[model samples]
Target: MRRRAVVAAAAVLTGGVAVLLGVAVPQAQAAEVSYATRCIPPSGIGLPPVDGTTKVEITAPAAAKVGDTVDVVWTFTQAASRNPDIIDLPADSVQPSGTLKAAGAQSADIAMRGPRQNPPVPKGGAMVLSAMKGSLKLTTAGQVMLTPDAYVVNALSTDTSCAPTQQVQPAATITVTAGSGSSSGGTGEPSHTGTPSHTPTKTTSPSPPASTSTSPSPSGGSGGQTDFTGKVVNVPYTCQSPIGQKRATSPVQINARKNGGSYDLTVQFKKSVMDSPIDIPANSVKPAMQVVLGGADKGSVAVEGPKNAAPIKQGAPIEIPDLTGVYKPGATGEATLSPGVLTIDALGTRTTCTPDSSTVSLTLDTTEQAGGASGATGGSGSSSSTAGGASTSGGLAETGAGDHATLKALGLVAGTAVLLGAAVFTYLPGRRRTR
Candidate 1:
């Protein structure tokens, strides 16, 4: 009886400890942070600020223990700006102990257009510059996991051009009060709570897996999906003039898929600008304007003249140079399992006098499925459609490889955690008896 009692007690204690630790082990230790920044502007700084309003929103983790560092990031957008240029903000520095919920760092950049573009230059549209800005604060309980050495914040553009840039003063410490870590009955500010009561904010907003709606079933491969019937239109531009025109010829085809099952789909596209030198001759003025149009995702147009040059009267002729021969051409699209919609926009610039290309826009009709095999397995499938008074169909849509790989990895991580948890609960008590 005593032996049984001893075993029982041991089992209960072991289970209790395991459960507590298990809860703690996965109870994400993170830091919650928030901040707001504004540009001190004189309106024109020679570098020509992005021709419109800009805004940024940052949501850090809620809290961390003593030594576990969490990642911090900033997401910025050019709210209603015409010129999809860059905006600069302060970087994060080493926080004084106790000043931060976690000891990681902070960072950011001009948002890049997409994964396809490396050293991702800002697509002229708002995009996440850096996946992670800097290191984070964390608990020193077991192994002290420190944050990265440095974070990359961005620099502000001058009124004249984006080439010559200026860096802003970065902030080092994250402010936290004593009783603020918890989501409720707490100050809502993040703080270090030694016990396992903190939840780490997901590093970098949880961007949905870049899935497509073109596939038949949610499980099929990228190629076995339907292609949208549409022509690619090029936005025209002109150097040194405000008047421009657009061509309805040389249309490109669009292909896509829907994740999950929904009707509203979002679109994304890449944008690039031409590097040209302006020749408005100092003091001489022409009503030069920048116009961005198309789609429900993001669009804007701005007209700015040289400082001291005569202001461009509304409805004035804005010359736009033709870009008939530029830009790569192809029918690109994908299929998604998650279902829903996503709209992506990109930006580029023209150095001298030229028109920026109209970003490729894809409206993923998330509600339709062409065949029997739902592209759910990430396998192959097929799609059928009617284009130009004829039957059109497609196969083998490659879900952007980078996107596919990332989603697969995330699934593996989650599965491993579940297995580990089941083992701990199922085997620990039996082993305690033998001990």
Candidate 2:
């Protein structure tokens, strides 16, 4: 009886311990898989150079296993060029494996235009708004997917183009492989790496609007996502002669990532530029405040030298001159330029160019003949009758002589002889005796 009691008590105690152990194991596993990601601006990193006029950050994994969650964070340094009325920062989540799981915005601070010291932000301080967070549970997963989200930014007192509101979003679906240990942050500038935080000491005066004009709808991704154009400096084009006839349309687009803000853009043109100057104004765009293009020579469209060369920013239109009369055939023109420089060759003479501002204007002349000129005259005047007669006779003789060379030659001689005989016998001094 004593042995039975002892055995029963021990079994009960073992069962309790087993239950506790099972719960503890699952809790530990969940903690490792679940992580909160944050997007700290350069300011958060305590770096003076952490500000991106516009910035996008990834702070978490999209598709996590059960008990796994991803944290994504985004940052906006300044206002973007398009949709000035709003500050757009949109994001989405997907599950590639396991389950799509869940997602949310977590927390967001709106940086609105402010006083010179604090500087008014685009949307101002964080306001109760939609898209603060999102929850998506994927039952099973083969391909994890994420979509874009648009955030509204109200107008602050400091902004000149301030409107009621604006929208922002990302460019594409950022993805990572299962168990790939992906960090949840953006691939932007360097981080502060645990530096002491310090806000800007002195605020720079707000620059004037580049332009007040609006433009045609700009192209971009779904969530304020303009097409992101790659570095396009070395593309070749035909240059006209007398230094003024090379034009190029940027085939690449500036894509605004779902989370939109200001961007530091650098364009490099070829060096052989010798034509009239180029013009990229800031008055033909919308929200973008500034667009600075570097790397070119001293030349301007409708103006003088390189120093006089103005910048192209948001709300500004690029004014390109008519290149038809400028680029003549058989001439050489050169334009050393960087990107964002538009040019058109009237003569269709494509030439290679470099990135030297000293050579921004070039002329390319046609080496081939011009139109409306006769071949014998070397593209000059009409052919004379004698020349025409000679050409016709030469061509006819060459063509006919191949088939009836002897017969044709004999017939010509016979005709000449008969004409001469008739002239002499009837009209010359040895006339007919009967008359």
Give the runs in model 1 whose Cα sits over 4 Å from its true position: 1-23, 29-36, 40-128, 136-435
Residue-level lDDT tens digits of model 1 in 223-310: 4553342223332222110111111111122333333332212221112111111111122221222222222212222223222233
Top model by TM-score, which number? 1
Per-prediction TM-score, please?
A: 0.21, 0.16
User: What value of lDDT does candidate 1 attain over all alpha carbons?
Assistant: 0.23
Best-fitting candidate, measured by lDDT?
Answer: 1
Clash counts for all predictions: 102, 122
Writing each residue's lDDT as its tens digit, candidate 2 over 1-435 gives 999999999988888899877632221111111111111111111111111122222223433542234333332332222221112111110000011121222112212111112222121222111112223222222333332222223211010111112233322222333343333432222212111122211112112222212121221123343323333222222222121222221111121111232111222221211111112222211100011111221221111112113443212222322111010111112212122222211111111211112221221111222341212221121112211111110000000212211111111111111111111111112222221
Q: List ranges where model 2 is wrong by over 4 Å.
A: 1-39, 42-298, 302-361, 364-435
lDDT on C-alpha atoms for all candidate structures: 0.23, 0.21
RMSD of each: 26.3, 34.3
